[model samples]
Target: MASSPFLNEVRTSIRVRGMSIRTEKTYIYWIRFFIRYNHCRHPTEMGAAEVVDFLGHLATERNVAVNTQRIALNALAYLYNQFLKQPLGDLES
Candidate 1:
């Protein structure tokens, strides 16, 4: 999956911005999870509504900790805002 062009682009974007390797890995992990959670739909094809659903799933279905959900939200924010150049604009968190 790391070899995929989209993931590679993500990696490149992270590195270009001087993000730590751990941050890179964490962001990639969450991004991949998000993609898989949405049945492999492209992030560019999704937006705030999808993000809201994923976060809701994390809280209600997966029962993740609040901080964990925040981390996932941060990863998606970076993916859209930093990598894809699309601001996610005031998500519910």
Candidate 2:
């Protein structure tokens, strides 16, 4: 898969701002899964349905704990809010 430009931007900003490595890793993981959940489509082209699908996969398919799922969601939300500057209020399940 091609490296996502959006993910690159997010990583760059996080590194430049001196974010913790854990935070950077978590954000990248979420963004990568988000992309795959939408069939490798760009996040800019995805909507609440895609987000919901990804979260559902985490909860049901992956059997992640509630807190873990929430953390992933928060990571993705940060990417949406900070990197893309896209409003995520409408994406809430």
Candidate 3:
């Protein structure tokens, strides 16, 4: 498969902000997982509903712990809120 400049851009953004290597890796991991979970579509095409489903899957089906779920939410928030600059409004309901 071809490379995704988008992921590279995300990585660059994280590094430019002086985030740790581990944090970058974790963020990238979740971002990638989110894309793959949604059938490899670009994140720009997704929105809050997609995010809600992913988080719900993590909580109900995957049975991830609370902190793990929070980490996933944080990763996605950074992707949307910080990198992509697309707000996922009222996601915490």
lDDT sort, best first: 3, 1, 2
Runs in model 2 lying further than 4 Å from the true structure:
1-3, 90-93
- What are the lDDT scores of the predictions, listed in order? 0.92, 0.80, 0.93
Native-to-model Cα distance after best TM-score fit, residue 6 in candidate 1, in Å? 0.1
Summarize candidate 2's per-residue lDDT along 1-93 as a digit string, tens digits.
456677888889889879899989888888888787777888888756777788899999999999988888888787777777885776655
lDDT of 3 at 23: 95
Cα lDDT tens digits for candidate 3, 10-90: 999999999999999899989999999999999999999999999999999999999998899999999999999999999
lDDT of 2: 0.80
Best prediction by lDDT:
3
Weakest ten-residue segment in model 1 by summed lDDT: 1-10
Backbone steric clashes in candidate 3, count: 0
- TM, every model: 0.93, 0.83, 0.93
Which residue pairs overlap in candidate 1's backbone?
none
Better of 1 and 2 by TM-score: 1
User: Clashing residue pairs in candidate 3, if any?
Assistant: none
